[model samples]
Target: MRLGRVFSVIAVCFFVSACSWFGGDEKRLPDIPEQQLYDEAITALEQQEYETAVEKLQMLEARYPFGRYSEQAQLELIFAYHKNFEPEAARAAADRFIRLHPSHENIDYAYYLKGLTAFEQDQSMFQRFLPIDIDQRDPGAARSSFESFSTLINRYPDSSYAPDAQKRMLFLKNRLASYEVHVANYYMKRGAYIAAANRGRYVVENLKETPATPDALAVMYQAYELLGEQQLAQSARDVLLANYPNYPLKSYKVKNTSLLETATFGLFGSESEADDPPRPTTEDKQGLEKPENEAQKEQETKRPWYHKATFGIFE
Candidate 1:
């Protein structure tokens, strides 16, 4: 009888524990109404609760895909993603909105936000306050940002965001030009004269009116000279002098030291090492007179809009 009582007590304890576990999970809050959910999301955004806002916005979209607040919710969702530092998601959302509502009145804003998202993606916390050269880094994000801004400006010239977009495009252009110059410099250091010259030529042909143009021309001149192409070098030099008369040119010389010797810090040297080679001298080259043809003059006079807008001030 005692044995039967013990088994019954154990069975009752197991049943009670199972009931408590299942009972707790059975109680759940009712689903919020669609309007209430959107309101809560907006409130969360206003209160700087970005994660909460994202959750609420997502729930609203899923619950009421055809509701009146659906369109506005999608737009707000893009902003919430941006604030939460999800640039890729923000860009995707913006693209989706644009595709779905091509004729939407606020389409320009979507384009602007897409560009802004790309612009902020590559910028790190250290870059904000540091005197860092953004151009020296990867140009992928900058290029994407530039294209997005260009699209906005071209599609909606009178957009409220056009001016800001124009400014950012100029900055990206200069950054891309600077990046080309950096690559050319690296090629020059490695003695890849042809590759360096090609990079310099690319800059001259594509990135006109930027600060890095003069340096690019110099690189082309040096690289061509190293490759024994006197005519090409002179052409590059003439263009540099014509555009920037005051820019200085540094003489280029081929180092005679072997790679092993250079790596070993000149440990293996000839008896005549004490005598330094004569440094090459640079002569000033005069620039040709400007062309008087109207077409040529117009081409030369064409400048970026930001140049005129900012009166030569750059960010």
Candidate 2:
């Protein structure tokens, strides 16, 4: 009986294996010609079918890793990923291409795309239409973008992308400077006057000619004055008065973010944390038969009309 049971188990395993083999064969994609795959990917890109383009490009690379169009496919894959709003994938593809083909004639193009990806990494789809303060978001992506552009310019000064990269670098520098002043303002509101002063000094000393210079000098003046350093305060004040006498700069204020913002990064949360939470399960029975449950589906919660239209980005 034990031998019979063992044989029965082996027969069952063999049947399962045969079924899986047939299933795999049925689901396998057709093997298209190398040139045909690359052309389809290119056609999808031209039609702005980014998802389809990404699918074809990815499949081409997987199936023809060393084909005639392999390098070009890899390069276009980065662009496809970028157009599909897959910044992380685009960055990784760009990095891989750069590493594998350091001497490629189009290496500067790879660096340019890497910088472009990082340039918009911090911005969500909602930010395209919403006038949010990007400087208050994060500076890491901005710095990364700047470094990529800088490297491209330094390594390939004569490359056609250098001029555009120079423009982007200037914008990044100003954005970074503005971000520093924003942080300095935050420190001022927290009463960390010394730290605020240091940040202001960094902007003024390291990032010159930026639009935020006046704000930085103002922060330094206020921070030093608050710290009882009259000499340092006067020096900062002197520079401000000398350079931007007409600019009306004031201390920046701290804002209390809405509690609902945690879900959408401060774009949708309008209610404060002080508001009452959902009722307890024990105290929820208020109806004649059964009270409506307070813990309902998050998607069922009522939101503003604008939020509903723009929630896709947050999602």
Candidate 3:
């Protein structure tokens, strides 16, 4: 009986091996029609299902690299990658499309999208929700964005996207200028006068027409003054005064912030001199007081209960 069972097992093993070696009829998945695949991707895009759209578009490209809709698919893939939060992939796709179809009618749009990808790369979820200083962040992406927009405008001056590209380029230019001013401000607080002055000079010379020009001038003046370069300091100060009359030197910050104050989001204390709220003028106080009687005026002038208890901190 044992011998018979061993023989049956051996026969079963051989049958399995034979089936694996010589295949029976196996069903194949039908190739999706090119038009159908493109339509599905477009539908997903219209529905704002960018992840699905990206998958479909990728599949379409892999299956139909030279199909009628290949070029349009490539363009839509760039947008889909951007919408799906794949900035690097979006930029790669944009560059590839631009290289492949240099004379394409929509080449300008490709450049525009490429610039926009880098333009928004620094804006994170925290920046969207918190009160973060955008100018204090990295400026590499901003510079790249500016260059891409510049290329688009220079190469395709009459393209339909040139107007919006121009606007974005201006925004990037100002942003880059402000970033330089912020760095210079930091260097000033660190007592690195030469570095601060260099950054300020850069903004003044190359990044004109920006709101930060006044701040840059202020930094340069302060830095030169601290370094005992009286002539250079006066030159910077004169230009600042000529352009922005009545500017307060005390309004600029060149001080260090305590760790506790910085960690508490300036709730413990603030280092910024420019952020002080305007004090109420004497005329403004008198306008609020009624002339009913001396007692009534005195009562009105009294602080609120919580304000007095907290020594005016709560108020």
Candidate 4:
């Protein structure tokens, strides 16, 4: 009978703990308004008490997931996780916030935090030999970061965070392009011409609107040329000519010089009118005589009439 009573107590305790987790006990929450709980969480976070902050913030999130302080609590929890160097935890918190509040005002901030978490967690296995990997550290995560930052800009163009978000987006764009270039260059160096050409073509076709497209197309041109694929080389050359005429490639070098020559000579019109020597007349036999304008008349009046008549012989 005593053992049965002890087992009953343990069962009650387990039930209470399970109930508490699902918000069955309202008294576990602070008596103050939700904002005050958030304020307390922030204070804990400021003191670098990450565990305490997470506890307080998680309570707020659980008890008031849709309350006025829910978003604030969620963001604070993410910050606390990040400050504690637990990026995966931080990302989880951020993801929950985004999924729950898809249309919230601070949704951009949620996305930003998610991106920051992924960026922070980025690392590669081939850190010793090749500083850059042909494949990115975490492309899926990096892509998520890109998407988040892009969405932040598109949605909150006028937000104060917009400027920082814009700069980060540019960095992500360049990094993504760098990864593609790394793969293409790797394939080219390995003599895998088809793979190199395909990788380069991906960048040119999909990211053609970006500044890196020209470089990508040029690399594809080189790959095609080396592989002895005359038709592919010509197609790549056409792409280079169409999109990046100013790029200095072997094919484009002469092509562009000829273009410059054509444009300079053709658009400037024929040099015949400008280069023709003046027709020879009596004026060429003697010094050229000035026309008899008012100023010339005044000057000529100061000279003798015979001298003026002699000068006027050419006129």
Q: After superposition, how far is residue 191 of candidate 2 from its true place, in Å?
A: 1.0
TM-score of each: 0.74, 0.70, 0.68, 0.58
Count of residue pairs whose backbone atoms collide, per candidate: 0, 2, 0, 0
Query: Per-residue lDDT for 118-227 in model 4, tens only?
Result: 66555333555566653445466666777877877788788777788777767677667767867887777667878878888888766656666777787788888887
Local distance difference test scores for all models: 0.86, 0.87, 0.87, 0.73
Error of 3 at 300 (Å): 50
What clash pairs does model 1 have? none
- Spell out the clash pairs found in candidate 3: none
Which of 2 and 4 is the better model by TM-score? 2
Per-residue lDDT of 68 in model 2: 96
lDDT of 3 at 123: 61
Q: Which segments of candidate 3 are over 4 A away from where they belong?
A: 1-29, 250-315
TM-score of 2: 0.70
Q: How far is candidate 1 from the true structure (C-alpha RMSD, Å)?
A: 19.0
Error of 3 at 77 (Å): 0.5
lDDT at position 4, candidate 4: 100
Q: What is the C-alpha RMSD of each candidate to the true structure, in Å?
A: 19.0, 18.8, 11.6, 21.8
